[model samples]
Target chain A: MERLKSILLAEDNHMDVELTLEALGRHNLANEVEVVNDGAEALEYLYRRGKFSSRPAGNPAVVLLDIKMPKVNGLEVLKEIKGDPNLKMMPVVVLTSSREESDLIRSYNLGVNAYVVKPLEFEEFVTAVSRLGVFWAIINEPPPGSSRGIA
Target chain B: MRMDSIRSILLAEDNQMDVELTLEALGQHIFANDVVVVGDGAEALDYLRRNGKYADRQEGNPAVVLLDLKMPKVDGLKVLKEIKGDVSLRTIPVVVLTSSREEKDLVKSYQLGVNAYVVKPVDFHDFVEAVSKLDVFWAIVNEPPPARVNAG
Candidate 1:
């Protein structure tokens, strides 16, 4: 059996997290999601400090980041990740409900791999998340040195 | 009805079979998009720049570019550099779709600002499915960069 790379989901909203998990579960691909409630926790997880120090030894396949957060914003985290040489290869997808052009431009300029605007309709949202899960987790090839260790 | 904002997908692949498969997979997607197939990176650039045979082409930009790494002339990396280097074309999303899973290639593609990097699946079914998922995700899910003035 192929090992699935863990997904780091940085979303502060409880409802969004639940919906995202449900969507991924509908596709039977939500087994490896590590949910972080805010940007600070996300940083802790990614940097493998504090609680995440003993969790894993490598980076997640992809980080689904929400723009609005408590401690640090998605764009700030993105800048931090892309600014670092070791973490620059990590695939960061901005999954936010914001349709602001500024957010899109900032995310792209910061080297976000993909930016997805959350769908408004319930069924459409599910479909979007399902496709996103399948694409990023199953289809898209993670960068070299990823935790999945694909060759 | 299809959304009016949905743009075309520019595929720059040398292999005829791959092109056919990609087009078929794209057809399977819900979003209707015109697939512009080019044989090599040079031709892809020409299409983007509206040069040579593409001199009188349409003015709209493609929603995304599925670029193959190896081709007859001006390989994928070169093409990527050219596109990202150009101020007008830099915003276009370029996904590197290739068979090579070499670390150097992956690193280089990311370094050159590729939006996504997908390895061509060896299995025929998986290949088609990968292309299809890519089509749906890029064309339907992802928001493309706003149009810019093309001074060509």
Candidate 2:
């Protein structure tokens, strides 16, 4: 049996988080999403340190990270992830409401896998994320289909 | 308005045979795009950066980047790093379309933050069809990041 791929989602806003989870519910793919409220927590989840120390270790197929956060922020988190020799290939899609040039600039500079502008319209946002779900989870092949964990 | 923005695709590949096959497959698409090819990774970077030789390139960004691995000089991995590292170039949605699926390469490319990793079909005909389908899907549907003038 195939294991369900994990999705690392780093979002600070509760409302947006709920809405995104709901949107993902519409998809047929039941990806196990590890939700982190901020960039710091997101990093922790990826590295599996702190509370995540006890959790299983395997990289997510893709990461959906938001730009605005209290601690490290998306760009900083992106740099840490991309710069890491072991974790760099994990696909990270920037799903954020920030249209700020600085945010975009920094994210690209840090090598975010994809940068998606969260649509102001709920429907548009839903559609965009749905495509993301299909493409990343269903269509795109992960790193060689190996059963090896992130470690 | 957004859909109209994607007018062309610039495929940076070093091999001439690959160049021929990719162009032939692109012919299957409904959308008409100028699929420009640069022979090597260095040339590819120059075209994208508008540096040295590619000084007079077009105005807009390609809808997507279809990158090949294991090229001479700069190589796909490095080019991918350069594109994703550059503030202006990162959002371009690079799909690593290559032959080598070494676990290290796969892990490294995704870690480097490639949008998609598609192993090219080894057979010539299969390769053409695969590349063609990639063009079709990205050209018609994928919403590429907008033109940003500031990325270096």
Candidate 3:
């Protein structure tokens, strides 16, 4: 059987992170999520560097990226990912609070797989994340050579 | 409201049966009238580019393009490459909906910047469910590039 791929979530807000985890957990999706606080850590996780150097060898099924962060912002991380040959194909979804046209245009221009604006209401947010999780994690097939989780 | 103001879905598939099934599945959430079905990749491109028979069509691009890998004439990959390569059309989301589970196709599609890839399920019910989920995510949840981005 094919191993389930893990999901790398790069988000800065603690409250949103907790809410997202809770939403994924409600759908039994929490086990696969690996969280990072900022863009630099996200790069580390993806490249398996720094504290994440010994963690895993393969890429996550999908990256749920938040636009605003303390260190490297999500757009910078997206630019780096899409620019690299090895990491370019890994699916990255922009799960952000910004509905600004410029951000939407830029993300797509940078080759983001999808861009979803975070819902304002708690219930709507949960539903959106749950649907997003189910679609990316279970329904959509990740590209070839994506992480199949640790054996 | 202008016709182009209503963002429709463009489906490029050669298989008539699959087209019917997809339309049926999408009909649950999206209006059947909102889906513009093309029999092959050439027509798909024509519709998108507003060329040949589609010269007089609406100006705006579709919200999402559901592409099937195997098609007559240009083929899905070529269509994807054309769309992604062209600055005017690159922002429009393109999802590959095909029966092919070939690794090379998957790799190539992603390399060309496909938004998502879904393998069509053999089971009828599963196919409908998958299509419904896909529709909900792309059409409702996903924020597509603004129509103004394609003004060029």
Candidate 4:
């Protein structure tokens, strides 16, 4: 079987995670996802610390990050990743419930690759994640982060 | 290579099915667009530079470009390097459209300043939906940055 890249999804909301997983499952994409609950944990996973110490060594093809969270928060995490030369090239798409113009401006200013406003409607959210997978996994290309391209 | 028009999307891919699907997906979207199909990297560059068969084009730069990583005659990475390195065309978004899941494809594309990078879904229905979303986002929702003037 041809390998599919794993997706690292960092979202604090359990329901949101469930729904996202369900939606991806409907389109047969759930098998490729790795879910993390909060910003602090997300960073640990990215940095390979704590429980993530023994986790996969390679970088996720893309990171689906939620904005608000306990501990680090999405913007802070984004800042750290973008600031790290080893991880700066990793494609980050801000998938959050935020609708504020300030968050949008901040995310873009922070050099976020993309910013997606999460929809409250279940169908809309599903469609968003599905398309997000389609574009991030299927269309957009990235310069190999520290992991380093085409097989 | 039609050189007379600068408003053309240079697509690089070896797959006929994906090419057909992309065209079909674009048709469903409301955005009016014109895409120039090239089977490989060499043709993509040729189209960009208005070389050989593309000598008479009028549009100086295409609005956007969609590239596939694995291709004969130069591959996507080399093509991306050339486009980004060229001061004249660096502002234009060169998106990657491929089935590759390797980290290299992702990181390298971003490092090159590619405007967007995406993986084509294997399923047909998913492909249509994905393309439609892209059309909505890049063509409709997301605003392209203003053009850059050459620094003297």
Candidate 5:
């Protein structure tokens, strides 16, 4: 049986994480999300190293990355992913509160698949995240070799 | 003028039926009327670069480009390469909306820096739903790059 691919969400703020998960939960996709607090843990999860060792062998369907995080930041993580050929094809979307043009420009320049600014209003934010989840996790076909199911 | 407010979608599709279906699907959204459809990859590039027949068209890039793989001239992959390689156009989002589910096509598109890859659903209802969802995400949810005035 083919297992649904998972979405990796790298966010530091507990409130944002809960909100995002809640938004995705509205689409029955909350279970598909794997949360990581910072960029370092995100990398570890992707690389299947450190604490994430022996977790899985394939890349996640998509990564919902936050720009500002403790330890390694989102841009650095994006650079690392896009620069590395094996992981480059894996889709990464920047989900941040930053509406700064520089951040938008840099994310696209770094080869991010998409950039979505978290809406300031509560309802708008939920709608945005839900739409984003549905698009990336369901509508978009992830790259080859992405995680299919549990071993 | 604030170009970001202009949420135009460029569709490069050779198939007339597919084009109609895409337009129809996109019609469900407010930005539906903003779509600019081109029949082939050459026209796609022309529309993007503001060359040939499109020389006097516009100065800003579309919010996103929905590209079809097979075409009479240039083809979608070539068009994607040109867009991603050019500094001024690289930031513009490009999504491959093709019928082909071949692994090579998927790999090639991602390698060429396509923002997303979506397979055209076979069923009519599914196709419409997919496109509508895609439209909402790219046009409304996602933040497009700051508009750059193309210098000719």
Candidate 6:
């Protein structure tokens, strides 16, 4: 059996994490998610250092990143990932609440794969996350070799 | 009041079955935006630049471009390079919807600044589902770069 690719979620807010996990659960995808609470932890997971040192190798199928978080932050993480060739091909989706034009502009400028604004309403947010989970996790193909890449 | 913001979708595909399937999948959702189909990469460029048969086409860039890798005249990768190279067109999101699963192709597509890459599923049901989700995500969920607003 093929090993299912994991999902790395970098989000600081408890509510958003719960909500996002709930949304993914609705699609029967909650099991594949591996949550990290901050940008620094996100990097650790990606690099297989710190708390993630013993985790199995291979990049996540997709990264659902929140723009605002403690430590490095989403845009910083995006820049780091996109700059490195080994991690450049990894799909990074900016899942955020801010509608600030600058955030959108900078995220795209940093080569973000997709930018999705977190909707305010409960039903809308669920719907948005559901669509994201389905497309990124199930429909969109992760860059080839991600399943074998260590960094 | 909102009509001016409507963004078109440009689909560059040569295969008739794929084209029909994509159209049918999109039709299932009843998307309000126009979908312009081009048979080759050259025509895709022509449409983007508003030249030849597309001379009088609308002024705004597409919300997203669904490009197939293999096509006559120029091909998808070349088209992608051209799009990302041009300052005005660079901001337009390009999603590679191709059948190839080769690692080299995947790496090159991402490197070329293609926004997303999706493999065309062989199963009919899977194909339709993929297209529908992609159409919904790109057209309805994503916020295109401010370039479209400026063009509007």
TM-score winner = 5
Candidate 1 on A8-61: residue-level lDDT in tens?
899999988999999989867677788998888888888888977777567788
Model with the higher TM-score, candidate 1 or 2: 1
Q: Write the per-residue lDDT of candidate 3 for residues A1-151, one digit (tens) a residue.
A: 4333388999999999998999888768888889999999999988889998777578898999999998999999999999999999999999999978778888988989999999999999998998888888877888876753221
* Candidate fnat values, all: 0.59, 0.33, 0.77, 0.34, 0.86, 0.70
Candidate 1 chain A minimal-lDDT segment of 10 residues? A142-151
Q: Using TM-score as the measure, name the better of candidate 1 and candidate 4.
A: 1
Q: By DockQ thresholds, what CAPRI class is model 4?
A: incorrect
Model 3 bad stretches (over 4 Å): A1-5, A148-151, B1-5, B30-33, B150-152
* Lowest summed lDDT window (length 10), candidate 3 chain B: B1-10
Clashes in model 2: which pairs?
A58-A150, A88-B111, A88-B112, A89-B110, A89-B111, A90-B111, B14-B39, B88-B151
- Candidate 2: C-alpha RMSD to true structure equals 5.0
Report the poorest 10 consecutive residues by lDDT, candidate 2 chain A: A142-151
lDDT of 4 at B35: 72
Q: How many backbone clashes does every candidate have?
A: 0, 8, 0, 36, 0, 0
On a 0 to 100 scale, what is the lDDT of residue B75 in model 2?
Answer: 95
Best first by lDDT, ranked: 5, 3, 6, 1, 2, 4
Greater-DockQ candidate between 2 and 3: 3
Q: What docking tier does model 6 reach?
A: medium
lDDT of 5: 0.89
lDDT of 6 at B51: 90
The TM-score of predicted model 1 comes to 0.91
Candidate number with the higher lDDT (5 or 6): 5
- Against the true structure, candidate 4 reaches a TM-score of 0.62
Distance (Å) between predicted and true CA of A87, model 6?
A: 0.5
Which regions of candidate 4 are displaced past 4 Å? A1-5, A140-151, B1-24, B30-94, B97-108, B118-152
Q: Please give, for residues A15-96, the per-residue lDDT of candidate 2 as tens digits.
A: 8787777766676543466788999899888887898866665788778888889899888888898889767767778888
Model 3 lDDT, residue A121, Cα: 98
RMSD of every candidate to native, in Å, equals 3.3, 5.0, 3.0, 7.5, 2.8, 3.5
